[model samples]
Target: MNPSQPSAPVRILVIDDTPSIHDDFRKILISRGNDASLDAAEAALFADTRSAPVADSFVLDSALQGQEGLALLERAHQAGEPYSLAFVDMRMPPGWDGIETIRRLWQVDPALQVVICTAYTDYSWSETIRQLGSSDNLIILKKPFDNIEVLQLAHALTRKWQLARKLAARMWDLASEVERRTDELRTAEARFTSAFAASPIASTIQYNYNHCFLSVNPAFLELTGQSMGDVIGHMPGELELWPEGKAWLDGVSRGDRLRKHPAKLRTRDGRLRDVLVSTEPIAIDNDACSLWLIDDITDRLELEQQLVQSQKMESVGHLAAGIAHDFNNLLTAINIYTEEALHECQPGTRLHDDLQEVQAAGRRAAALTRQLLIFSRKQFSELAPLQLAEVLDRILPMLRRLIGEDIELVSEWDSGLPMILGDENNLEHVVLNLVVNARDAMPNGGEIRLALRQTVVLASQTARHPEARPGQFLVLAVADNGCGIPLEIQQQVFEPLFTTKGSGKGTGLGLSTVRTIVSQHKGWVELTSSPGAGALFEIFLPAAPVGTVLEATGTAGAGQPASDRHRGTERILIAEDDDVVRNMLAVLFPRYGYQAVLAQDGPDALAAWEKGGGAFDLLLTDMVMPKGMSGIDLARELQSRQPDLKVILSTGYSAELLQQGTTPPIPGASVLLKPYRPDSLLAAIRNTLDAAAAAS
Candidate 1:
């Protein structure tokens, strides 16, 4: 088919019985000119403008018989140059005839162009056609062969054979290429399948029409604890792996693609897991599908919940702190007045008994407000390094009566336990509130256990208590066989005002105050509980240095009327902010048998002192004042004027009154918390004046 190269020589094979006939056929075909133009008058009449040029010369070989001719054709075919055309004698053999030889040769090379050289009497054309199936490669020739006719047959048939060979070669190349591409595609698919099977992320491919998994990774099976057989043919909803799984199928069918759907799922074994599922639209077999990626996020969500709750509790604590301060000031006035009335009453009288009841109620109110101040971390702590065991000894008597006969209160202490730096009253409140909370949990009554021991916390162990660091600590544990906190809401129980008790049944500040006070002492709380198994609360406080001595709450002694303890002629200057509280203080000391001067705030008291020419023996001042100067500044000025001036400072909770370190603002000044008894006020005043007198 290529037109540029010189054409291959037309090789011919001639078969006959005589050697003369073989030589005669070769001379006519092979010994011809290279330019063999088949163009005659008819060719000229029907030719296109560009006609094919003359073919190259013919090359011929002869065989004396049919067998010899077949042998010669086989040799040429194996040598890569088979004859394109053959001339056959009609009566060639004593063995095989030309008709049979032609049949055999056509079988060997089906495309071979042939000329049947025969006389009319030798065989009919119809018979020749019958011997070989009719084909374009076959041709007829007369036995008295013309040289021109033989040459033309050789040229045209050989040219047709060359075109056929080129076409076959091109077909072979195309088949090989197609087969190679198919193998490559198969290899790549195999690799992708292996990788999908081995993946760690939970991945799945599902059908678009049915929402069934087309393929699932091993991790997807592992996550749901389902086998491949359980997953493949079924929808995700069918297996109950997703929340309201059947409902989601409706959404997906509506062409809604869920990018990231987060929800809780229960596994096959019934473990709840928080998970995030993301989906991408994919194409599978002419329909759009989904590729899903799932992640387990249970622990992460719990930690985030803890962080949010902590921030909420902290915000509420700040608000409660301010309210507690103002409340204490009001309670202080009520308590002192009640105490003053009690001191004036005679024993064993109905009026005296009523006043005693009022005093007790006042003391209880004061105690409750102090706990509020402690929860806010605003109250000044009366902290000293003390033995928890010793502190428990004094509080146990009161706890036994408070717990009641319905519930048994048991105490266990480890002897020679380590010391902890803590506020005695505040620590006692921690135990009181925890025990009271425990008592409420058991309406039917249950045993409460109180324990004190020394323990060490390592860096790894400190994770259990987020507010604490690695250190030695004294642990105060309280356990009760009461209705326990639920697992889901365990972290919320310590939030202020968050309670499970019915209306008016509980204040809900009990555990919140316990946690707040313990945290203020650089300790942490740990809890362990089950729904019906009761609860255990352990308070861990940083241990004090070795050899630190224990401090105690002062012991009381039986005495005469508290009002008769102190009598002074000296003028006492009082500085207070609230009008009712100021008036109460003004009338109070005079009842105690001492002269009193009254002023509303710091500036008023200072002006009164200057106008009186410093005639006061002692300055009685409130720590937090509305305007002018604070009690600390007032005391500083008064002391400068009279170096031996005695002083007493009163406060509930005030940031302004607290100094650097845990010490009181004014050095050498006596301090009284709000709502103090007439006896306590009288004692502090008497002690300050006496100490001044003794020092001078």
Candidate 2:
């Protein structure tokens, strides 16, 4: 196919009687660079009898012995040699004349070029041509044929043969190229098919309208339980086992080309399976085909259902906690009132003793409510950077009391442990819950080992605990040499209301609440136990900065001491929509030597502040009310009017509004959690007024 290659030389064969004719033709052909050979009658016969030379040749006669030339032509024919031009001499005194010879030669090689030579203008020559058939290769010459004519015929015939050979070679190359390309295409298609079939997700191809399957990979066959023979030509919807096939076809007809749908399929064995199917439209040769990908999501869907159930239980727990919180506030007020009344009477008096019993009962009810709030995750956590050593130092005495005198408690603190961001009270609860579980695990007696260490959780380690993220963590491990949790019940230990303990022994919410609280703080809990070995509960919390280690100064067993009760007559504005709660505050504040003004909502509170001539020492407002205004908005307005006014915003559920910061700066204030005691309320008001006076 390279154009620079020279063309092959043309070959010519001339058969005639005269030696002079042969000489003339050879000279002409050789001059044209065409390789030519002359074979006399004797030589031709000898060459034909022996091995013939691999070259084109011309035979000649003396217009006599025509039988000899004819014999030579038969020899050439038998050899399968092509003759380009044959000039036969006419008027030969032989068995046959030149015209007859030409006719015979034409019969021998239809593609051979022939030219007749004669001395006379014979009409019989025309008759010979008619018998030989109308061929472009056949020509006639008058006697005394000019050399020019002979040379011209030789050149034309040779060029024609050359062109024919070139065309044939070109076609052969083209055929080879086409075959090679076809093989390559087949190989690529095979590779693609292998890759598609090996994919983990099930893949299939179906015709657009009829939904007839075009091709399905092995995964598809495995998923559908149908072979290529069963599915290829039939409409997918017609297959009764695949109900979703009909729905999928309907969706495609409505122009939804790509979709993700969940389906239930009946397999070949009549087993039903849940499948998630995704389909995409592929256009091949301008015809639409659909590609389907399927996944088995029954297990995943079931887990999600469990998660939803868990969330619902958590919601119920929150509702219970809110009720408990409200009830606790009422009990605090009742306990305080009863105690005050009891103190006024003599200890032996009947009324005094009755008041004492009421006070004691209220205190017990309040403790139960606090535990309920903790279980429901409604109790506020005072989170701070804490050291493990300090927590142990403070909580050991209480822990000893909790486990009783029979069981010994030991601690192992890693001195290199980093500070953890957590609530000290919640941490104590975590310790208490684990300790109590350990105690129950060993009904008789056992030692509780509490250990803390700095650890790193890598990405590889996170696989076992799917909820955990890889990072450096502070591991607080509680291991008890007690009877271990059973393998069957280990997973259920963190489920709310699930317990191994009998009904009266436990509420079954302790471990569940511990896990919830830890999760809220972006931490994870791991429980390891078996029948013989003691249980190990490892709590992993992300480590805080080392510089953040601040020792906790307060005792874990006691709340912060009440601030000095302020007895000064200070004007306090209270905004509350609840009339009963408002009336209680109004009567209670004045009894503590404070003037309390009332307002039903934000508007009324603002109006009362405006009328009070800026005389109020502090603004105490509820967060949610009937009007469009909120406590935050009212506080902003009050601050604008009286910049120095102290404000304490109160809310039952203010989580949605609280942003992440030490102090979310409202214009005039600090926020107080709702349902506060009289002492706490007085302390907050007193502190705010004192700070205001100091700033002035």
Candidate 3:
């Protein structure tokens, strides 16, 4: 077995009186070891399964009698690697029968799957059921069964057991986390109760009637600028802490108990501070005393304001996603129809000009929809090892055009900077967003410098930021000598749709997209600025090991011409939900010399395939639909029936649907992101089909 294989085998126990039976199971269940040939054969046979090549390896343990089997199971349970299945013989002699053995095993581990093997009808089905009761985990196997049947049963039951254990573990983890969080909250409340602002909050103990300080915590001393000796045994009026005299101090009993009183306290340095004082009376050493809880509301108010802004941004993100989903469907229809019409018109015609304008408008709207998805953080980006220097080289021309010639753009990077794991295009978007934001800040024009260097971040350095960690990073900085960001609003600069630019000029999503992209790349952004000085935005991306090469990612750029797209007369099946979009694809596929068959959903597509006698050159299906079957399942079924068929899945939003989150790519199918141009979609189909042909 490969040591790096992620999952361990499902263990099985065989309890029988005959030693020969154990030898038979070993021959059927255990392999010498899996190798390249076995893997290729397994993939060929079971490629339709989501987790293919998962032929369960078994660890078989045998016992001569039922009593000894129970002992083994108990020991396995103690070892934390209990058996997933047990094969019990009905005719075990000189001990408890199969039924009793199963009963005892269930008492220890109720989740064990059991299969009863017997040659004679010694215990009828009704008798077995009456003794053991019916269970989903119990099944009966007649003696002399085929080797294939037993092996198949082993594989299926073991996978079922593994899935159940994982689910139970996940539920346990969630319960544990909830209890842990509740404990933390209770601890915080206890700290608030017992300490009375002694730790970080300002606290002062004063005597009654005269209101002279008896003791002051360090926090209080710092706030009031008074030493322990200076504040002790001296009245607040004498020290000028609260120079309004003791009239408010005497009002504790004059109004109500446990009331909050507002006051202005003057520090020794003559600076007045706003405070909320919670006054309560207590007896200390048989004398009346007051414990005043003074809270500085300056920073607290700012925290509350930030909480409100965060809540507002969350609501806006939800709204943006809902709108983008609906808008993209409309854009899909508009774009296809305009492209189809453009082909029928002559050059230099007014109709052609009008259609061209419509297409341009549609293109701009599509770009805005992409921006909205990026802001909402729903845009699918596949992260990989990439060099930032190469990304800069690819986008420098566009960057130069973005910032006018009035602004001087400078690029600097280290000579041997390590690679970072990120989505290359998304990283480019971050650079563009930040530099454009810097350009907007300097209306009169200024220099914008983009720099990349390697740095190490210590734990102490990340103590202040929640999204940062201690590690090596590729630091990308975008700095501008522009009108600096005010300290008051610097924290809100990355908020979605919260722009300082005037209407009709900026959409306020630039910095918002930048923050989302950087964070998604497992990095953090730190901003430093002073009023009218300048601003520098630093993005720190976790660095991968040296020699990590940049990987090629898929793109939706204009592809080869229709002739070069491997145009063919092969028939293709398309399953989509939207009527307009489906009909448009049906019309467009024939233009590339491919025949088309259409269905409204997965089931409809399957029915069409069956009606065509399960034969087609290729299958094109949408990832989502209103029917019971998804495109992934539909493809799996069709591929199982016709092993050589080429398949392509398209989706409007998610790229993870077909593979379902980081599971390896589907063995024989390719994915096309939705709202793809006509030429691009054809190219994807042709390339996939040609590859299938070559493999065959």
Question: How far is each candidate from the true structure, as Cα RMSD in Å?
Answer: 9.3, 13.7, 37.6
lDDT of candidate 1 over 294-339, digit per residue (tens)? 7778778988988987787678767876677677777778887777
lDDT of 2 by residue, 1-696 (tens): 311111333435555555677677666545434333333432344445244322234322223345665566667556544444566776665467766777776676555566777787664756766766667776778867665566556555555654555665677678878888989978987886888789877787777776777887787677778887887777666556566567565876444665557788776666777887777777766778877777877678879979996797788787777687567547646765675466468988899888888877886676566556666766545567887568877988988888987787888885766777787767787888898898787778888898888888888888868688888898888888787889888888887778888879987878987887687567989999998788999988888866786754844323643333545588888998766667677767777688889999988988888898878878888766768887777888888888777888776543423444343557547776554556666677877887788888
Write one digit per residue (lDDT tens) for candidate 3, span 109-160: 8888899998889888899899998888888899997665677677777777
Measured against the true structure, the TM-scores of the candidates, in listed sequence, are 0.63, 0.58, 0.62
Q: Among these predicted structures, which one has the highest TM-score?
A: 1
Local error of candidate 2 at residue 652 (angstroms): 4.0
lDDT for predicted candidate 2 compared with the true structure: 0.70
lDDT of each: 0.78, 0.70, 0.80
Task: Note the clash tally of each candidate.
Answer: 1, 6, 0
- Arranged by TM-score with the best first, the candidates are 1, 3, 2
lDDT preference between candidates 1 and 3, better one: 3
